[model samples]
Target: MTPFRTLTAEQIASLEALGNTAEDWSQVRVSEDFQPFQLQQSRLEGEVRIGSEARIIHSRVRNCQIGEGSLIEDVTALECRHRSSFGNGVGVATMNECGGRTVRIFDTMSAQMAYVMALYRHRPQTLAALERMIDRRVEERQSEIGRVGRNCRIVGARFLREVCIGDEVRIDGASLLENATLCDGVEIGVDVKACDLIAAEGARIGNGSTVERCFVGESCILDKGFTAAESLFFANSHCENGEAASIFAGPYTVSHHKSSLLIAGMFSFFNAGSGSNQSNHLFKSGAVHQSVHLRGCKFASGAYIMSPALEGAFTMVMGHHSYHHDTSALPYSYLIEKEGRSHLMPGANLASYGAVRDIEKWPARDHRKLKRDVIDFDEYNPYVTQAMLDAVNILHTLQEQDPDAEVYTYNKTLIRAASLQRGLKLYNKAIVAALGSMLDRGESNPRHNGAGRWIDAAGQYITRQAMREILDAVDRGELTDPTAVDNRFRIFDVHYDDYAHSWALQVYASLLGHTPTVGELNDAIQAGRNAHAALREMTDADRRRDCSLDMAVGYGLDCDNEEDRRRDYFAVRGLK
Candidate 1:
């Protein structure tokens, strides 16, 4: 341990002059950089320990351990009632707020892990073991002194209790923050009230937001007085002026504008327009309803859906929907309410130009600059492809089982026979698009061979087979800690391409219904790549059409002639 500088009697007198008092004078640990002139009207109580270059003005702290270069100004109170791991192992009741639906919030909680915890309740022993592991972590984090990390600023805060603050954090104008763990580079801004939260690195919570039992992932923003409860928002999610409950929001889930309530839904790569909402209650006794909004879904303004509905990937919903629909086999389509009935438009979103840009721009939009591990951004992976494969199977089964039915209705969702056929084509197109990318990579590098079932545990994509190997080792006492499950996530976090190719290979096998020889795989790969290249060309043409001279006819008001118009178009569009 580094030695602490002993202050002179004159320094003690100077500290007394500043109206600063400590419960135990011997417990006060200052450094050579410490200056008495910097502290003013601050009270340190109950085993409080402070670090060098600290500026404490108009604040009172009890059992707090403040780090070097920290600034605590105009803070009402900072205290710890008891030993806490902040958010770890704290049970949150989601969906039915009743018993048996409690999920443990840990620092390592990811959307994929939470998915397993929430949906895999059928595996009691496995869940119990995971919960026990988290509880052990909670116990291990117990400390008498609440910690404030280095270079952090705690200004104008109402109250902070048992919170583990991280390096370079800023918590200003927060009403009440208790039992929360803030990782490095987190910013909690004005009028924020939170409890039992674990905000990952570069996460921001501000603008009068009220949050409880929430895990805000890296670079996520919850601002503009948004209210959230029992939600697990993953990387780069942004929610403002909306209410969310029991939402397992995955990467890039954005809901802005007022009166938007996302409740009891599992979503990823989602975008919600103004007044977008979901009804989880059936006007019944218990709110046990939940839904899954698969990858790249969007909801138009004033859109609503009654839950227990499972929507497919990249699907769009519009208008108020009282009738629940399970459109799990229909990707790149619209589920619209027409005259109080639902209508499905197949292969519509595939033509959307925005869809191409949305996927391309996600990597650039990441706000987490300090840490890369805390942020997850992937275009093609097992999670989405797995869903697509499942959708393909569903469509195939539906068509084969009811060959004669003109209209098919199952699980409250309706699909026309003709539309079903179109949906299959669209889904296959999507799969082929992914397969093309994977094959191009594989062809470019023949030495690498990645094959298997990928599991999305947190943001990491690991082969289920690899995970089982680790778990088997754990069961044999080769791996002692249950947190070894985290290793599976870490593997994919670093080696994403391996997992990607693995999933691609597995999906290819499933599509053909048998394993192909290397030569056969190559032939299929080339054909898919050729088709995908044509598709990409078409998409590029569509993109150009938006900014082309034809689309900019009204923009060049000052143009004299066709030449001037061409010049103006080039100037504004900035492309050939």
Candidate 2:
């Protein structure tokens, strides 16, 4: 590639003849093979550089660099106001709207990093070190000239000020994009108004969405008039026709309803039904409460919950729950409201077809081209299984406390006797199955990590000890940088199987009261396979309900006979 050269007298004369004007012609520089005729009716100001084969038609571009093969046509104002960081150092108040958990969002920040920043407020020194590192990187990015990378097309844009456009980006009819960073492969569609935002690679913002002070992660889609502020939406999360404020939406968090409001919460691998909303304020004080919904959770239509609640993974919530119960110990449960009282059915969603299908579909639905988030898609990993183990202990203790009681009360939610017994069996089977699965992986030699507790750091499952070592290193000035800490997280993901196997060994010893011999291990593996089969059968029965006559009522509307109705239903649904 040849170096940029000042516009020659002949090229300057030709550009003026083509209705192009510059504040100072000498300040305009172009590539060695730049074409003068490709630019028309544009005003350039304050040291503008255009690359080879790049065209600017009917636009006013000031203090900008246009990369090779880029096009800027009919844009209202493409200018850099002053020295700016392009949304690199913006602080998004995620998870808590009251300002305790603010994450400084940057261009290269991943979901795991944001998770640690938002949730690990207990570790102040580590957080401070991470913030200092981000601040240094942000300072390094300060510039007076906006940049449009190679192959970018900005057509019919209204107001783009102090923005950085990366390679292969597309911006058409964007209303206002101020102080924003559109990373590589981003698509900004009609009427999108994004301010103080960092959109990572492969993200799309369109359909009249309004985003302010947010970090839109890789391959995310925000459309259909969605409004978001002070939020962090991580990889592959989709939001349409809804509003999100002060939310930490991790990977695969999806809310597609027009009436849904996701605010002041942490959610991952979540689904929000229509009219699903949560209250962060009780009218006693300002909106200070925050909620945590773990991965693979779903809020049923019109469901409501008061904040300061923590829900378990893979739990399905229905109706209105104002009790603010924390069910973090019970995974794969149902939290339903009955007659104005909260009812908890433990381990019920293990048999749910939707829950099982969600785990299967999430990996297939991932659309990220440049994947940044380190995600593990296993359904029965150590994170949820640890919760299952805790729930098993709690259920057994409750049974021993009152063996004849019909209803058990825990955490302000009532659990029936039948639910308790069923949950015990289901959790035990799942635990055994997970142990056997880990055993089958042949990780006979356990890693030093994954001994005690496990945490789902956004989409990555890591042991508490491994996470502690990283944070401790940061606090002691040994890590000192975000990249080093992120690498540690990535390494944990790479060795996830080993960590899980170690945790499974602990679980096996705890369950059977001794280290498993070779024969016992073989028996456990066979039993685990049988348990997996039984769980699958339960889910299969739940799936068949979708083809039931009641569910087929809306289908086969044009058919009168039962046979024709069944045929039309099966045909339309692609079921036999």
Highest lDDT model number:
2
Indicate the worst ten consecutive residues by lDDT in candidate 2.
441-450
How does model 2 fare in lDDT? Answer: 0.91
Local accuracy of candidate 2 as per-residue lDDT tens digits, 1-576:
437899889999999999999999898889998878979999999979899899999999999999999999999999997999999999998988878999998898989889889989998888899999999989988899999999999999999999999999999999999998999999999999999999999999998999999999999999999999999999999999999999999999899999899999999999999999999999998899999999999999999999989899999999999988999999999999999988999999998889989999999999987677889998768899989989999999999999999999999899999999999999988987888887666374544556888999999999888888888988888886677888889988888888888888778877789998889888888888888889999999999886676788777788878899889888988888
Error of 1 at 118 (Å): 2.4
Model 2 residue 419 lDDT score: 99
Best by TM-score: 2
Q: List TM-scores for all candidates, in order.
A: 0.86, 0.98
TM-score of model number 1 = 0.86
Local distance difference test scores for all models: 0.75, 0.91
The TM-score, computed over Cα atoms with residue i paired to residue i, of candidate 2 is 0.98
